[model samples]
Target chain A: MSDLLEARSVSRSFGGLHVTRDVNFKLTTGDRVALIGPNGAGKTTLVNLITGDIAPSEGQFFMGGDEITGLSIPDRVRRGLVRTFQTTRLFANLTVADNIALAIMQRKRITRRFFSSSTELPEVRAEWSEILSHLGLDRLAYRKVVELAYGQQRLIELAIGLALHPKVLLLDEPAAGVPHDEAPRILEAINRLPSDIAVLMIEHDMDLVFKFAKRVLVLAAGRLIFEGSPDQVTADHEVRRAYLGSYADARRPT
Target chain B: MSDIAVTHVPHKRNIPFAQEAAGALVILALGAIGWFLYPDDLAFLTRLIGIAFLVLSLDLVTGYCGVATLGHAAQFGVGAYAAGIACIRGVSDPVALLAVGLCAGTVMGLISGALITRFRGLPQLVLSIAVGQLIAGLANKLSWLTGGSDGLSGIEPGKVFGVFGFDMYSRTAFVFSLGVLVITFVVLQRFVRSPFGLMCRGIKDDDLRAKMIGVSIYPRLVVMYGVAGAVAGIGGALTAISTGVVGLDSVSFERSAEVLVMLVLGGAGHLWGALAGTVIFMIFEHIVAAANPFHWMTLVGLLLILIVVFAPRGLIEPVVLLWAKFKRKGSAV
Candidate 1:
């Protein structure tokens, strides 16, 4: 099958320090891949490169075989490449529903409207309801994003990403800063997402990586060390030594 | 798909109809009261209406969009000058003059917005102030065309549609300005409640998130800035037409600062706040100046300090809070 996204030997450097080095990546439809590494493994940088948040110092990016290396971040989003931020970037003052509704309106190409309220539309309302319900955020729909707990805000971030109907989603630590009890709900939300969409999630939680991602890509020192099934990833000596650490043996299934 | 529960979710829509109607009613009531209270001061009332337009326009960019600008009066001056020049060259129709002001304001908005939006926070404020000062300086320097420091005089807008002549009593000017104010307020009311307006609010609240949601922030702000300029321009044009004079003060930094004060005093994001702020500030200024012209500035300063300390959001917040409380009480019953 043709890859939905491809990064050909992408390398990004910040003047004397290379954050991403000659990293090649590919994602296809229905692929649930986990990207795990140490603190500076350039996982977020790779996602940024692909999402057009920052340009690659060298190498090219493509979406469905179309060269998108020159596209701006919004243009990339328009082409169905969406992402969630590590820091939970949300419209703090707007209600959770309004936050989701914004994405729906933008997708509908009706945000430029000057006379009508886009939220009053039945289709937009239905879309927000579905997305919010899937993330189990329906109860907090009317509340402002800032007022919600960090865990709820993270879910709202995912909801916003989903609202765009992305073909490929780049989630930068979806469960980071979320309480342990709430992390499973975030995982469940990801599991409930439509299988047609490809997902590349950057996470540090081994339990989540093992339980959620079918496939796994491990990064070490800005380079891909291993790409395999989650089971094989845990077994790989280099990955275990470089990233999994002592948790590799402890996390192994009998 | 089966897991998706299709509940009958009642969306929270901005009820602009009632809000806008109330706002319009208040403005009209003010006009009526002013007409009756000071029948001989129609000229002052007309000037108040004109300044209200400027404040409303400022609210769109500064309040809603969070664009830190102090040179908004540049567009006002542009409109005033455009209307003044049109009258001098014999385009004396009120509607035609308004159209000229709108066009000039829009162009100026586009140019200044393009320049100012390139920076953020403090730089934006400095650039805006600089632009306003530049326009004011130019008006002063171009004395032959603009009448310079002496101010552009001899502008006589013939009549309202060639029917109602401008009388010495200033009644025509007052009625014309009231009509303009009502029309502009209604249009702006609809605009601020629209999806485009929501997008602006989004950008204002969190611009980075706005970009992440595929909103092209710079261009959207520029468009908003242009719209604001056109509105401010209309105000300036009204002043030129009603007073038959356009001065460099129209583009002065002090004028920009005064309008900013009016908007903040009323409340920034709310459209009604513009009218409320302008009316309160102007009336207080007028009353105090009459009482003690020299020390009026002192009272205004004290009032601003009190407002900032007590009602940081502006004077409208208390009314909004009370209205909300009243609604809650009624609903509870």
Candidate 2:
């Protein structure tokens, strides 16, 4: 199948040090891929390159066979390539519903209207409520984002990404700071997404990776080391020594 | 899903009609009060309204969009000169002058916004100040067209809809400016409540996230700046028409800073803050200067310091807070 999103030998360097090496990657529609690595593996950097947040030093990016390396972040988002940050980034002063409604309005191209309120429309409100209920955030819909707990904030971020109707969604550490008890909701929400929307998640939590990701890609020191099924990843010696050695020992049958 | 009751929390779904009606009534009351109290010095009150418009325009960019500009007076000056030049060339209609000023202000705003949005934070502030100075210097150099430091004169606005003439008593000018203010305020209220205005607020609260959500930040800001410019231009045209003069001081750096102070003092972001800030600052300046002209500057400086220390959000913020508190209490009862 033709790749919906492709990174062709992408390399990004800040001065003398290379952060992301010539990393060639591809993701097709309905693909559930987990990119796992140790700290400094350049996982976030690759996500940034694909999302058009930063430029590659010696390569290009394509979305459905069209060159998108030169496009701005918003331009890329318009083409249905979206991402969530490692740290939660939200309009702190705005309500949860307003934050999601803004994404929906922007998607509909009605955010430029200078007289009408977006929330007053019945269809818009229904969609907002549906998304809020799906994410279990309906109770706090009117509350400002700043007042929500950290896990709730993460869920809101996910809701915002989903609101864009992205074709390929890159989730950068969705469960990074979420509490242990609340992490299941994040995983459940991910599992609940429609399969047609290709998802590429960068995660350190092995349980989530094994449960949610169909294919696993391992990286070490700014280069892709392995790409295979979750079972294959755990058995690979190189991946074990380079990254997953500790997790493998913990999982071995006594 | 069936077990959980979907309790709908009341949201601010639309603009409150009662609040709008009260605002209109307040504007009318202010106009009547000014006419009654300062019948002979109506020109001074008219000029204050004009400055209020300029400050209101500035609030749209600096307060709403978080542009951090310090050279909005460039648009004001451009509008003033545009109106003054049109009048010199025999476009004596007051409405025509206002239209010319609006167009001029928009063009200037677009041109400056292009340059200003290229940088962030401190550089943005510097670029705006530089743009203001550049326009002021050009006006000074091009004396043949602009009338240079002698200031543009002979701006005799015809009449209100070819009816009431602009009399020497300043009655007609006062009414015309107040009418313009009321109309602009109403339109701006509708505007800031719109989706575009919400997008601007989103940009202000978190620009990166706004972009991530697919908002084209630069163009939105440029369009907002243009709208702000047109408003500022209207004020400049009013000044030229009412006073029969346009001066270099309209576009000076000090004028920009003064308006910024007024906007901040009244509070930024909120529309009523613009009116309150301009009125309070201007009245204080007038009273203190009348009492002790030499030390008025010191007194004003001291007053600003006290305000900054006490009401950092602006003078109107405290009243808004108090009103919100009172409403919460009444609703609880």
Error of 2 at A181 (Å): 1.8
Q: How much is B311 displaced in model 1, in angstroms?
A: 2.3
lDDT of 1 by residue, B1-333 (tens): 243347434444356477668767877898899899999889988999888889999999988999988899999999999999999999999889999999999999999999998889999999998888888989999998899999999999988988998877789999899988988998898888677888898999988778778888899999999999999999999999999999888999888999999998999988878888998999999999999999998999999999999999999989877986786576446
lDDT of 1 at B294: 97
lDDT of 1 by residue, A146-165 (tens): 88999999999999999999
TM-score of chain B of each: 0.95, 0.95
Candidate 2 segments whose C-alpha is farther than 4 A from its true place: B1-19, B322-333
lDDT of each residue in A200-228, candidate 2, tens digit only: 99999999999989999898889999999
Candidate 1: list runs displaced more than 4 Å: B1-5, B11-16, B322-333
* lDDT score for residue B109 of model 1: 92
